[model samples]
Target chain A: MTSTHDADGDLAVRTAGLTKRFRSGQVAVDGLDLAVPRGAVYGFLGPNGSGKTTTIRMLLGLAHPTAGRAWLLGSPMPDAAARVLPRVGALVEGPAFHPYLSGRANLARLDAGDATADPRTSRRRADAALDRVGLSAAATKPYRQYSLGMKQRLGLAAALLQPRDLLVLDEPTNGLDPQGTREVRHLVRELADGGATVLVSSHLLAEIEQVCTHVGIMSRGRLLLQGERAALTEREAARLAVTTRAGQADAAAEVLRGLGLADVARDGRALPGGAGTARLTAALGPTPPEKVSAALVHAGVDLVGLEVDRPSLEQVFVELTGEGFDVAR
Target chain B: MSRAEVLDGPGAGLPVAAPAPVAFARLLRSELRLVLGRRRNLVLLAGLALVPVVIGTVLLVTRDSALSGQGPAFLAQVTGNGLFLVVAALFLCLPFLLPLCIGIASGDAVAGEASAGTLRYLLVVPVPRTRLLLVKALAALTFAAAAVLAVAVTGLLVGAAFFGVQDVVLLSGSTVPVGEGVVRVAGIVAYVGLSLTGLVAVGLFFSTLTEVPVGAMAATVVVAVVSTVLDSLPQLSAIHPGLLTHHWFDFAEFLRVQVDWGVVGSGLAVQAAWVAVFGSLAWARFTTADVTS
Candidate 1:
């Protein structure tokens, strides 16, 4: 990964050597540095066992660091949390509400203070936030009566009502179905556009790759990689195709040796079509597509058609994770 | 209210002062609303409010023969079997039961959010740990008062109902008439409030210590029970009186023939001492605890 020191007052959060360990001395978040700019949708990505949530908690001062420091909105964490919190909002870990309280009342009850909110105004805010999250119809319904996705929305609504500068959401889509997930993804983009700094952590790399301007990856309590989303996946290579006379296909493979494309295989026998025609596959490392195509034509062995496929983020994930994970099915 | 005001709300150039009393009071009110707004809490309050009426009726029903044997003097005095039962019920049971309930209520106040994952929401918002703990403690204290009053009011009404309102006899053979007895009872109610202050603090302290509701409730109850048991033993009586639970029943002696103001006063002092000691520790621990767990 490429690293450079960038000096800018635009950072919403900055941390150096941040670490946390539980009572058993098991480190949950190791020494790590993170920089998230204001008004940026930062995605914290990692596997299930990674410390994404732990890092977020420490950033909010909900949890103390074992041996490092962090700052939010230009102020030190925990001590400065109070001064900065009024301007920030967040939903972490999971969605929970007082089971007996209506969804709307739950938000209204989360008091900025007890000036005794005008019930009407409080309801309007609660309803508006809920409606924004598509939970308006369930506003009066008790939390226990709602589904998991609805509860998640209720939590998001509570955080949004504060008119804060930042929103920290952890696994906000864990229990969501496809539809709910799409809605939340849209909301994240909309909130960012409206000028809220959003820091979301999730195991869904594809989703993160789609919405985040910046991304950080953690594993085994340590940050493995972080940077602008575009720069992280630059290792994509090109795909190649070849066609040659029947038995001559094997001969054509030897001629392309200098390109470093290996493991060439033919579609059928290495014999020509009618006279001699064969097809093959090659692993090319971001080689020029036109060069590969022209090389085949120059060989005098009949060249058919060639195609190239660029690498995807999924491929990058596998490379980072040591290997592609196996699917249960 | 004006178009200009509406348009300028975000950048109106209004200098924002530090949220002082407004923040604190709003926090306190939020706490009160949470504790008092629940139906179950109200039910508990209703039960306490009707204690006097219940006692009056039970006594009126059984007053014919059993009433003749016990003098109004013994009835007013808290030393007799009936009043002792009342005192035991309020002082012993309430502290154990009510504090447990309050702990149950406030126990989940912070940790529940952690477990539910909403603590992140509150923490991320930067609510001061000290202020958060204070608000929670205030909530528990309000519940504690309600819990204590429930027992005291209920006990007082039963005593008045059964004994037919008369002079209260002190353990020292001193006597105070019904008018004075009422004043003393009010004082006793207040004392009960003070006595449970430590329990409230304990529950709240435990609440911050762990994320489990049952764990907090159990810790608070166990500490109270153990302390009370330790204080009840005659072997430890000398040192026990200094303990908060030791003087929990000191108010009972007030109903005796001669009032022992010295003992009652000592009990109040002990209660206050426990409150300060436990309260300070609670705040300290809560402020330093890591919210991740």
Candidate 2:
């Protein structure tokens, strides 16, 4: 196997031209390139059937890739799966456990299945994990009796049974209520704060925006963009909205255009607040807000107000993928 | 957070400790627990135990004249030789009951996990697919052996109470000591258990072909029923030797004063061949098949 370590070993996950195609000839993941830097809370954002789960599966060695190579923790996957997987904890897609076994017993069995875990300490660790996930009261309940939220918590508890170098959670808060979602979000922040690299996948832009340090947006089995959260949001062009005196709306537009700003639009009528106020919006490309303010003042246009409308992540995501946000895929 | 606290937290600058490698023995133990701990399986076993009791009671209450000429040859001798009860019960169960239970267990080995959405988790444990398949097959075989033993033990206890143990009479017209007769009965029970190895392989192969446990179970039992049906058609004589159920009854040879090694050996060889063919097929399908669930 090839060594996965880069110069500084800063990447927790790396893939070069990774691809997977089902037997029916449907391409699930198409030559995907992904990089998750170490110590970063990377949110893998994608729609349903967008290949997020498939990519995660291949990285974990649960599904064989039809093309390309991937590495986890600086080790080439599958070839090094046995040696590398012990330090990686994952909760993929949804929770799955034996219906007959209690939550504690299920975790104990999963822990015992790990070659690196000491069986003697497994019971205590299982109990600790349950407590960490706030499922201590239901630890003895059979898994079948668990509600959807409880089952999701048990899945999280299983992933926390050991001290892991990385945590890969796919749609972790799926099927969770508002309170449950908040608890999971808080726990994710705590885990990341405690220093484990986490790769969490979700289609919720608001959720990703709140907790992720870096983000990768995927659509139609392809990654559209990946970068630091601040950098990505910074890349979007902020709109300049100018509220001018009633008769000066056309003058403000002409001034904005004369300043070499393209895509400038003048409202047909004055602002609803008063007959003297009119709003003109212009797309600011690389021009500072001070330039627009100075140009309007020099052009003798009465500027009632001027504000820079920075694009939200949701708008940026929609612009990047050419698809609507807010709807669950 | 304090720098000192950050340093003590998980994955913070501290080297991550690798978990202890899972032993093959532990995997086996876990597999056994998973297969045997189900309430459904326990109930199936209880039902199997009841078969012997019902058969023994019927034979014990009936008059000698009423049963002398009825049912299997072993049934006629159940009142005379108590050990025959064990052999008689095995004979009655082998054709369907034993194979049915084995089919249900083996068929659910992989498909059940897939349907429950647990197969993905198991594979991610880094348990090599081939090793997981082997473990599952072994668990199914263990169930088959245990099922046969349950019936045999139940039959022995019930038969010993209904009819006193005595020396055995062979189909060859020779008499053996009681100890030897008990040993022969054990050999027959073991042989019957071995006879189901082919069915276990068949069930496992079907299991790998689908994600629905019920579909796999029905398909596996159907395969056995079809094989038996084909075995009964003398017109298919050319293929009779190849059928899985053709040599199922060859264990009867163990009842003779001098065992027919030729027939017994051939039976075992056929079962082994079936195991090899179907076992390889299961491994091939499982290792290459994508787990979407």
The candidate maximizing DockQ is 1
lDDT by residue (tens digit), candidate 2, B1-293: 35463355332553333433346667778889988888888888888888889988888778455545488758888888778889889999888888889889999999999998888877776566887899899999999988998899999998888887999998887899999988888889888988899999999999999999988888888888999999999899999998898999887888898898999888888999999999999999998887888
For every prediction, compared with the true complex, DockQ reads 0.33, 0.30
**What lDDT tens digits, residue by residue, belong to model 2 across residues A1-329?**
12534312578888888899988899989988888898889999877888899999999988889998888876688777776677788899999999989999898778756766767888999999999989999999999999999999999998898888889999999989988888888988999999888999987767656888999988878888898987888797778889988788888899899888878987666466597788888888778889899999999998889988887778887887677864426
lDDT of 2: 0.85
Residue by residue across B156-219, what tens digits does model 1's lDDT show? 6566445445565555667767577677667666777777776676677677777777787777
Deviating ranges (above 4 Å) for candidate 1: A1-7, A113-123, A238-308, A324-329, B1-18, B46-55, B66-116, B154-178, B253-261
Task: Write the residue-wise lDDT of candidate 1 on A15-119 in tens digits.
Answer: 889999889989988997988898899988877768888888888887889888887765567665655565666787777677888988778666444222333
Lowest lDDT block of 10, candidate 2 chain B: B11-20
The iRMS of the candidates, in order, is 7.7, 5.7
Structure candidate 2, residue pairs in collision? A115-B20, A115-B21, A115-B22, A116-B19, A116-B20, A116-B21, A117-B20, A246-A276
